[model samples]
Target: MLWRSPRREDAYEIHELVRQCPPLDLNSVYNYLLLGEHFSDSCLVAERAGSIEGYVSAYIPPLTPEVLFIWQVAVRESARGAGLGGRLLQRLLARPAMGRIRYVETTVGPDNAPSRAMFLRLAGHLGAPVHESLLFDRSLFGPDAHDDERLMRLGPF
Candidate 1:
């Protein structure tokens, strides 16, 4: 797979990828367009044979440049397993723009074992410890049924 920064034209496809990857909240294509156009430095996409296989949406918070808050990770079913998720993350951190990033933060639902495991493996590979806390309670989603989102912080590496 060719890992590279996302392009604005990839927004619709990325949105569709997220939509197919269930359990992951799908955001508006406009949101992805903004990330691609403005935060491309912090976002990444993997393509093979001219097909988008995976994508990771992340950004360095304005007040905390050292922290990379990953918004979403989506890998097509055909590309599942084989460590594509972890590789995507490693590739993201390896970018020159992410040189100062010391902490990686993401939210995972309690029952999302695949996501939780992928993040834990990333922390291990970074030689960092994992710290987790409740970031968003299910109740905060109001009437929309949603799982409680817990923050996962892997850091200072």
Candidate 2:
């Protein structure tokens, strides 16, 4: 798979990929377009034979330039277990725009073992420390609609 920064044209396809991964906070295509266009430097997309197979949407919060807050990661079922997620992440952080990044933050659902494992592997690869904490409670989803999201921090890189 070709791992590269996401393009505006990839917005819809990336949105589809996110929807396929149930329980992921599905967002509107417009929001995805914004991410692709405005945060392309921090976002990544994997293409296989010209089709989007995986995507990682992330951005550096304005006041927190040292932190790269990963918004979402979605790999098509056909591309799972191949470590595309890690590759996409590494590439995104290695980009020139992330040269000053010192921390990586992401929220993972308690049941999402794959995502947790991927982030752990990333932390190891970067030789950074990892910390976990409750970041988003079920109440944020209104009426216990979804599981709480735990924060995963890998840093000082």
Candidate 3:
């Protein structure tokens, strides 16, 4: 696998990869390209045999000057478990533009064990802490809010 910056042309393939995952959303791809323009060299692509296999879009928001937020990360189902996600993340972390970023953060939805595990492994490698939180929501037919739901935040990457 090879890690490189994403090009406008890779949008479709990236879109498919994200679509195949749970909680699918494609609108983010367009936003990613728009944001990519501002952080030109930060968006990345992972390819194998000349085909796009995965992608990650990370940025250091001005409001959070010292933190690098990993806005999105997705690997083609066929490419999962091959370390492409980790490779993309490692490349992002090494960029000189990210030097001032002391922490890298991402949110994994409750019940997403694969993602949670990946974040835990990455946090271990980076010596960062994994913070957990509960996400509550109200039902359309109910008065009481939903109970605890796990969301993980692994960072300081």
Tell me, by TM-score, which candidate is best.
1
Q: After superposing candidate 3, which stretches have Cα over 4 Å from the reference? A: 134-151, 155-157
Quality of model 1 by C-alpha lDDT: 0.93
Least well predicted 10-residue stretch by lDDT in candidate 1:
1-10
Candidate 3, residues 74-102: lDDT per residue as tens digits? Answer: 88888788777887887888888877777
TM-score of predicted structure 1: 0.98
Writing each residue's lDDT as its tens digit, candidate 1 over 44-150 gives 99999989999999999999999999999998998898899999999999999998999999999899988999999999999998899999989999999999999
For each candidate, what TM-score against the reference? Answer: 0.98, 0.95, 0.81
Off by over 4 Å in 2: none
Give the C-alpha lDDT of model 2.
0.89
How many clashes would you count in candidate 1? Answer: 0
* True-structure RMSD for candidate 3: 3.9
Error of 2 at 24 (Å): 1.0
Residue 60's lDDT within candidate 1 is 96
- What CA RMSD would you report for each candidate? 0.7, 1.2, 3.9
Distance (Å) between predicted and true CA of 87, model 2?
0.4
